[model samples]
Structure formats: C-alpha cells, structure tokens
Target: MILIANGNASRIGIHTSIGDFAATKDGKTYGPLNTDGAFYNMKMLMFDTKSRPIGILVMEIPATSATSEADAARQAEALRKEVSEKIPDLEWLFQHS
Candidate 1:
C-alpha cells in the first residue's frame, strides 16, 4: 500500500534495491515521485507492519501550484474527487492480486 504524509511522518528509515518498487513503469524505474509544495511538506512511503522492514520513500509536496486561495481550494477539491474515486479500487486490486 501507499501512504502520503505531509510532515506527519518522520522517523528512522532505510533504502535499498532488493525488492519491488511501485514507481517502476514499463520496465523502467522512474524512481519515486517527490511531492513538493509551499505551505507544508509531503511524503510518500511504503511499509509492511507485520514484516520487520524493507524500504522507505519520502516526498515533499508544495502548495505553490495555485496562484490564489480560491484557486488552491478549487484544485484541491478537484484532485480529491479524482483520486478518491480511483485509488480505493486500485488499492483493492493491488492487495488481491
């Protein structure tokens, strides 16, 4: 699974190339998506609670994309709707398959 954190997640970590990477696409490793913003920091991470540990990723998302507050609000709402509709199903498939 994937976890997105905006400065709420920070701890000891590890990075290695021993297993699967989610950003790997079309036989090409695009690496991780580094989320960056203005008002706060963002991060993306993968972990298995039952297992000891494997890998970790950190992303910083910026709130600098919007030119104004209203624009930011609108964009945020749109992105929320778009992602909320698809991510859950995608996650279910990922877990089941």
Candidate 2:
C-alpha cells in the first residue's frame, strides 16, 4: 500500500505491501478484491490472511503538522513505531517518499 501524508512540506509518503486480501475491520469480508472499490469505503483497512501477498495502495491523512525538519523526522518515527506495534511482522521500507 502507498500512504501519503497530508499536511505541510514536512509530510511524507509510505509504500508497503498489502500482504493479502480484503476484509472489513469488523471481520466482514469484501471481494478477493482488486481495484480499490471493495475497500474504498472502509475507515480502517484490514486484509484476509487467505490471500497471497499483494499491494493495495492507501493514503493516510493525519491531523497534525510538523513545523520543522526535526519535527517531521520525529513525527515520522512516531508513525513508524505505531505501525510496527500494530503489525509487528510487516516490513516497511522508508525513504523520502
């Protein structure tokens, strides 16, 4: 998935693997779904373990702004930590993107 941070120049973008199929956060399943339509309406994205690893690009808009380069780096670190805590096994490749 591709996550684009919305805000100031301090924002960032993240590209990661979707890792599988789609399902609602409440466990309601969607299509073996490609094309984003099945997953677009979701507030939080989740995937089914039954499917093969795949990329489903997504963008996350946060409510905060980082005013400086250092602040941006700190914010990015916090975001990474949050994601790691949520999906410990998932791999993340970070860059200026």
Candidate 3:
C-alpha cells in the first residue's frame, strides 16, 4: 500500500505479511491488525490456543492513502477480502498467528 506522510513530502509503499492473532467479540478470528497510524483502528479480543475460535480468518491491511481515512479503510478492507479469498493457506496462517 502507498502512504503519504509528512504532508506528502514522504511517500511510503509497504508490502506486509501477517504477523499476529486476534479474535473479534463474536468469536471470529483475524490478524496482524494494522497498528500503522494511517490505518483504521481495529480492535479485537486476543486469546490463547485453547480458546480455538471459529475458523473464519480475516486479515487487515494498512490504510493505503493519506488524504482520506475512509477511503483508506475501504481499500484495506477490500484488500483483506481479496487476500482471504485468494490465498489458500490463509487459514493455516491465521491459526498459527
């Protein structure tokens, strides 16, 4: 994703992979929640392996733009959906994360 920082003087494009695990209130699983300041703030309940959340995996991508937070959120969600649908081992990674 491309991010414009320092009032557009510094632009950063990042390619990131998933890193951590978290669960939603409803027992759904997702991960690597983008802690990047430009991304939407997503919160999830963290748990240990014994909890074994239901196997749906959602991934968060960092917000892709600096101008519009809403657009960046939409882009991130879309990328998450695309990755979840296209990447076959996403579940395994989610489990391990």
Give lDDT tens digits, candidate 1, residues 1-97: 2433235455223333334354322332122223433532222222333322223333332455655444544454444444444444433424645
Sort the candidates on TM-score, descending order.
Answer: 1, 3, 2
What's the alpha carbon RMSD for model 2?
16.1
lDDT of 3 by residue, 1-97 (tens): 1221124344333322233232444543333325555454432332224433323323343555433545544554555455445445424543544
Best by TM-score: 1
Instruction: List residue ranges in candidate 3 displaced over 4 A.
Output: 1-64, 87-91, 94-97
Would you list the C-alpha lDDT of every candidate in the order shown?
Answer: 0.36, 0.35, 0.39
Ranking by lDDT: 3, 1, 2
Candidate 1 matches the true fold with a TM-score of 0.31
Better of 1 and 3 by TM-score: 1
- Candidate 2 collision pairs: 1-16
- Decide which is better by TM-score, 2 or 3: 3
* Residue pairs in collision within model 3: none
The Cα error of candidate 3 at residue 64, in Å, is: 8.0
| Number of backbone collisions per candidate | 11, 1, 0
Poorest lDDT segment (10 consecutive residues) of candidate 1: 24-33
